[model samples]
Target: MGATVEVEGLTKSFGSQNIWRDVTLTLPPGEITALLGPSGTGKSVFLKTVMGLLNPEEGSVKIDGVDIVSATDRETQELRKRFGVLFQDGALFGSMSIYDNVAFPLHEHTDLSASEIKRKVGEKLELVGLTGTETKLPGEVSGGMRKRVGLARSLVLDPDIILCDEPDSGLDPVRTAYIAQLLVDVNTETDATILVVTHDTNLARTLPDNLGMLFRRELVMFGPREAMLTTDEPAVTQFIHGSPVGPIGMSEEKDATPHHLLGAMDHLKLGDVPPQIQPSEGMGERAGAVRHAERLRTTPDIEELVIRQPDKELERRPVTRPAAYSAPMRGLRQVGSLFALALDVIVNIFRRPFQWRETLEQFWFIASVSILPAALVAVPFGAVIALQLGTLTVQIGAQSFTGAASVLAVIQQASPIVTALAIAGAGGAAICADLGARTIREEIDAMKVLGVSPVQRLVVPRVLATMLVAVLLNGMVSVVGVIGGYVFNVLVQDGTPGAYLASFTALAQIEDLIVGEIKAVIFGFIAGVVAAYRGLNPSAGPKGVGDAVNQSVVITFLLLFFMNFVITTLYLQVIPAKGA
Candidate 1:
């Protein structure tokens, strides 16, 4: 049975900018509701808030009586199991084949056998008219086909509530009509509470059993479809009629427009109410259909509009989740959260059946990217250090000890720092971008919906890989650096090869090499954690992902330098310098 979703007093914002406020509505169980709004009125944000993927500033979203705002992670995950969302672009796993994409939830949440899963996948494919297309990837399909695949995947869960965000976004009119019918047929079959966020007026007018519109950040009207179509509210009339002369101006996307343009946002009217699309022949009526029809007959024509004046009591109600944290505490909070995530990663490292394969894959990838860069940098870096040291030693008439000075500098500092820079610049940036893309696509949300721990599943393996690659690359840099320094000193500085090799052992100890490896490990941990932290919480879109990647590199470099300083200070204090 479809679950009832009750949203009350919902408010959302980003920084100081409010997206919407006081959003209250009820999605009657086993009914199809289409929410109409201008292009940038936070329709997608509303879907995220409803799913608990994004927290609302002040509200309660009770799904089958579980208040999503206050629900624990586990509770939220379980609640999400009852939900299936089709994002604007379908949000299909681009890498996975259509079959695998549809089967992803089953793989995550169920213990079903392979043959059984295959059969179910086939049935869903057939249901969406996509049976033979199973082997094809999402990228290989047409836009309409991809939307159908997303629909099939969403339906596979037999969820109690379904959310489709812009199902007709890129489709032509003919395909859009097919999609509309597909959705109606789906509702008839599953009887799930469904919310469709769209801007298609034809869709808005005909498809939904219930109709609603969001304008100026509030739900302007919501009720029986007839009531909305017949209402004379300027905004409602303007939207349903799909006219340009409405309050939704260029400022529809922005906060303020010129005062002179305010009157330009004038008027439109709702024309004749077209015949509402009904459940198709041979498709049994939805559970809510009879009740909705009964309401139309019994209720007044003015419509029981969901819009309301601000309730003073509800206005004073506490928001379990604030729109934004105070600026002063945000930095401290981020640092604390990073520490907590570090601890979590450390603890998860020892958890049984560790992600050895993923860790190894990441290790190979990071090592491949970092090794050449570290080696190339180490050669010149080592040469520069040895040349400077040899010249200083000659000036002091202590050329014999120049090898010791150069080797110690390279082994104890240059090698690990170079390795850290390589890992962070090349490897860390990629990690941040990958995770940020996943975060923005709601793939992480999908994992959580299937009761998977993203940190444990994704972050842990990637972090371990960074550490392991650091250790490996540290050795590579150390060897290359020492050889580069020795060659540069003996060949370029007019020094004896025997003296240069012998002086290395004259003053350096095993502890110096060990300390360098230690730094590499800690630096790798810092880089990985910082990258993952930012990636997990990117701002909003592709731009957010790019921003996160850049931030990861900057943050990793700063932390590496600071950590290098602390480690160097501690190492010098704990272990005295070796004697010549």
Candidate 2:
């Protein structure tokens, strides 16, 4: 049997835009409830809030006496195991195959053997009628197939509560009916408490045993399916019957026209209420229906029991303008939050159960992909320094100092700065884009729901890998830079090769190389952290991802230049070299 979800006095908003307020509902055990609402009514937001993905401002969501809203991270994680969420658009990791995506939760959260995981995944896939398509990626599949994959993934964990957000979206009528039947079959077999947020009138009219509607920022009614079906409430009737003559207007608000009122009455006079579609005959009685049967045997008339209760009245208040300090305060809070996230990563980076595979992959990507750009920048920078310094030294008749000047600049500044820029520009942007995509797709949330820390699984590995590759790439850039200087001095400037090589190490100290390496490592860490932060907390949608990537690049550049100044100053003061 599934657990009940009780939401009381729940309020949520994004800045000044209130999505819903004082929302109260009870999802009974083993019953399927459909939350119906027009677009922009916050149905999806309500689902996310119930799943603990977004915290309501002033209320509690309790499941089995545990208030998830105020629960600690560990407690909330445990609670999330009982939830199976099918996000709109599937939200599957684009990189993974269908089988791997479905099996991700089990692999991350359980110690099941490979064979067991395979069997369970195969079984769930078969249950969703997605057998033999396990090798396809999410991008390769049709929208309906992706939704089925999402459904299969959600069910693989045998969750107590299944939350589906617009499961029928972007599907044909036949596919929608097939998915509806699949939901019914799953509910019958598992008896999971299912809450589906949808706008499909057909699905809302037929699939769920109970129905609730959200309109004008509040839940209008919630009760047995029969009670809703038999109601003459203007909004509910207009919505369920797909009529345009009642409360819902073109702008999704109550119509204010007397003509609209007359049209609604005329439509009502036609007596055109459609019959509720019954469950298929051969499926036998659903477990949910059986559970309801036991309740009905004692209550006798559950529909009337629900109808007599007053609809929840939400007290509307004037929307208050935000305080003058709200923007600055929000910025400060974000800074603090990012600092804490970085601190968490540092504290847990050395903990046991390392993500070695992900770390290796990141290392390979950074080291290989970033090499050419680093070299390209370093070589030109070194040649320019050599050309200018050689000309100046010759004019002053101190040609021998050309080697020392070029070598020192390449080792102390050019190599580290160039490699850092390359890594931040190339490697850092890649990290940001990847994490941003994952964030937008809700894959990061899925990982959290599966009790996986994205910091450990993704961020730490990338940070460490970038740092490690930065140090190595610095060395490569340094060598190529020195060679570029050598070529410029000996060939282009007509400088003596013997003097160039001889004076190269004359004033260049070992301390310079050490400081350069340190700077490269530090810059790489800063780049990785900034990129991960921007990526993991993107605003929303494709535009958000683009903005995050831009912010990461800009932030990384600022931090790199500022930190370079600080580190360079410290090295110069500490070291006793001639040009440090």
Candidate 3:
């Protein structure tokens, strides 16, 4: 099935800054088109917008005569099914096996039974030349293999159009050639239109039927692959030849050339005519002929392209596993990895167990970093709860209940949530940032190759440390907030400290403290794990590390809040709020 995708005058901006403007292109059916751009040129943003992952401020993208930009949510989803995407990082779910990863879309969108899903997943894996590796995790595979898995996943749905974003990044030349060849083969076999976003000039020039480049947030050129690539145009020549001296400049400097300068970027002329591609009709041709004969019955004009003879079509010089792991080895590796991680965690926990140095460090950070918000919000909040409780106590002529109310509020709700958030921002972001830096420097990769489990060496220690510190921080928050509440009671409500302390102890149950401590431990472990996961998967460079830190805090805060509600609900239902 062929598909034609059109992006008409697409535009998007953030605040006062325009990301891209008036971007227009038409991708013909049954062909591969390349989208090329430098770093930070909004390549990803444009792709996301095309996929309806982001809404453009202006214009529309139509797929096979359907305008996705104007579509409703359901319509957009339906449109998305027509196109499959392979993200740069593979983006496989870390928690699933290879088979399940490839089978995810089918499971979610189809009514296929277990047997059918398994069969289909196995078939796709075989197509990708990854048969017999069903049980492997993505982390266990090389980068090239992961990309194949990603490609397999994308093809499982038999999508009419495929969108690949930076599919050749981080891969060797041989792997890049293989991937390009695979795409060409698939395009021929399925007659599916494909769009690839990339920066590799050779890969781009050699692989696609059409080419386009984004410069200055606009399409610098777009045309037949041969026409665009083998050109004397200064800009196109400079880019295709990988030259630093060109119309483009480093650090945002623009050549004030006239806008209407036609072919300003084209600098070189075509010197040689490449040869044409023709697949061999070998003894194996009998099978293809038989298939072609069969296909002719259903539809005529089934021209068979010999898989091997496509040099001209291939844009010149380009062109171009495993087994069930042994059960014992797998188990031993997993267990040893876990144990080593546990040992490292234990060592880190006891390494500074004087309870003064690291504990004080945590205390100072939690207090200093978090005190501003805590003081601003908690003090006023305490005052409100106190005044409300005090008014009720006075009306009932049982003024001592004000202390009971303050104690319950702080012990049950305020301290745990406040402390978790504080730790999430301070300790969690710090860990995420640090680990992210290590990941960028390839330290984690080095450890992995050296037979060290990153999870044990890195994750276990950080999680254990966080949980240990959180236990103490939760206790401290409770005590400090309670004292602040009593001070608030005395200064604001004129209640005596002795009566306040006495009433607080009388009404506060041990269960409250136990619940608070349990919540802290859970939150701390979750925060640490989340921070480490995000950091370990940090983006390609420095900005990616910052993003990891940012995402870690956000996701940690969300998870902490969610867990708080869940635990609170369970506590109320099962524990009965201490003799309620």
Candidate 4:
């Protein structure tokens, strides 16, 4: 169904800090509207309010005649289902493949079968000119590609209304123009109502059927594009022209001007210049009449092109068309695309291996730098376990078994799990934090634009690297625990080193080492992907990187413990015991 968005007398405030107050606007169906404003002016907040992601303290917003804020939960959900959002940073889950990201809404919202999902995802990727990059993670592609993938994902929902937050923020001039043209073309084709929030005046000026400026907790201006663009109002004019002088003030500067300069500027205006406006010379006389006659010959139809230029000017420049995706057909294309993506991923894994480098650095820091902590833990822990078992042996008149008890407690269970936890605390958090920071800095976005999946490119590599480390760390723990226990055995019970080794060998089995290996493998993947995913979804700007980093470590630790427990339960209960 076609949709229209209408907001009435919206008011929202946090204590004394008002974001927007009594803001009202009507966005007609089948047109692009831009919410333009300076930074911190609440453009994003307004877009969020429209999306029903936020509720105003006082106001009513209706999409297709349904009141979003007052609607039932089901109604609210249905309302959201009608609209698609392209977050400023793409917001593709780092752990998921590009194909999975595009297919997410379909999977979540529909009961479509796997084959159907693949077809739909392929079509959307083709729509965004990303046919073969599906299996690759978001991190491997460039910024532009990531944004396009975000657009493709938004389109997968087949939304009649699209909400884009800062769609053109970091792109270059050419890419920005391409995006603007793409939006217009998409709107023309699909007739979707689009609302874009951006601080870029070029995008704001060239696009949009209607323009609105958020300021001082309210929309100070709202109107048709041409009307707003041609206005000389202080706030609107100053912002549009990139001027520093306006009602906006600086605390350190006093407002003073040369009276003569102001007077001369005022006196030189108006009719003295004999009107600077000029009529189009190319469409004059016979040509104008011919065009007018041709217009009458055909049905009246006018579509707003964001860039208005003469026919002659356009004829001279080569026109670039938006990439189109063919409707999916037979089995071959589906299989082919999947194969291509897999090949791309395999190639990328060996290409740069950035995450591999990071993992190696992380492993080095964890194992080498953390030696003191390991020693501290092992010495006390080994001594305590040995002493406790020795006291119990004396009570039972079996004091010789102290060496065997220490070997069972420290070597079989304690060492592997403890060392794994330590490495997770040290290395896992670092991995997550590092990746998360890169994501916020747009480094991940860079990879997406280059048609590389950050997951395939970054996460897979890191996962592999960490797995190797986990295996190595477990082996190291076995060695350290043995040495630690042997020292305690000799010092306390006058047990020989040979006896300590002999007892450990007698009790330990290959399966125990294998169990530890399985846990490490899972832990490494968990830590790597968690960190990568958190990094890729970081909030806007510099501070968000730091926030993502901090959150990644905390979340990774929790997940490690949770996953370890699940693995342990499966090993103990799900897998048959020796007798079973």
Best by TM-score: 2
What TM-score would each prediction reach against the true structure? 0.91, 0.92, 0.56, 0.55
**RMSD score of candidate 2 (Å):** 2.9
Lowest lDDT block of 10, candidate 2: 307-316
Candidate rank order under lDDT? 2, 1, 3, 4
Clashes of each: 0, 0, 16, 17
| Residue pairs in clash, model 1 | none
Better of 2 and 3 by TM-score: 2
RMSD of 3: 16.3
Better model by lDDT: candidate 2 vs candidate 3: 2
Q: Candidate 4, residues 176-197: lDDT per residue as tens digits?
A: 7767766766665566888888
Looking at model 3, residue 242 earns an lDDT score of: 71
- What TM value does model 2 have? 0.92
Clash count, candidate 4: 17
Candidate 3 stretches greater than 4 Å from native = 14-17, 254-267, 273-580
Q: Which candidate is the best by lDDT?
A: 2
lDDT values for all models: 0.84, 0.84, 0.70, 0.65
Model 1 lDDT, residue 474, Cα: 88
The residue-by-residue lDDT of candidate 2 on 463-494, one tens digit each, is 99999988988899899999999998889999
Please provide, for model 3 over 1-580, each residue's C-alpha lDDT reduced to its tens digit, 9 standing for 90 to 100. Answer: 5688888877776434566766777887777778876676788778778877667778899988888889875577677877777876776656568898788788766899999998889888987789988999988998778878888888888888888888888788887877777777777667788889998877776677677777665666676665565555555556666766566566445543323343543344444424212122331222222332354456532222111111233223321101223466655764465445445555555553233543445445544655555445555555666777777888999987779888888878888787777778877887888778777754564233222345654566667677876787778777777777788789888998788878876677898899999999988877877787778778879999999899889988988999999988998888765445
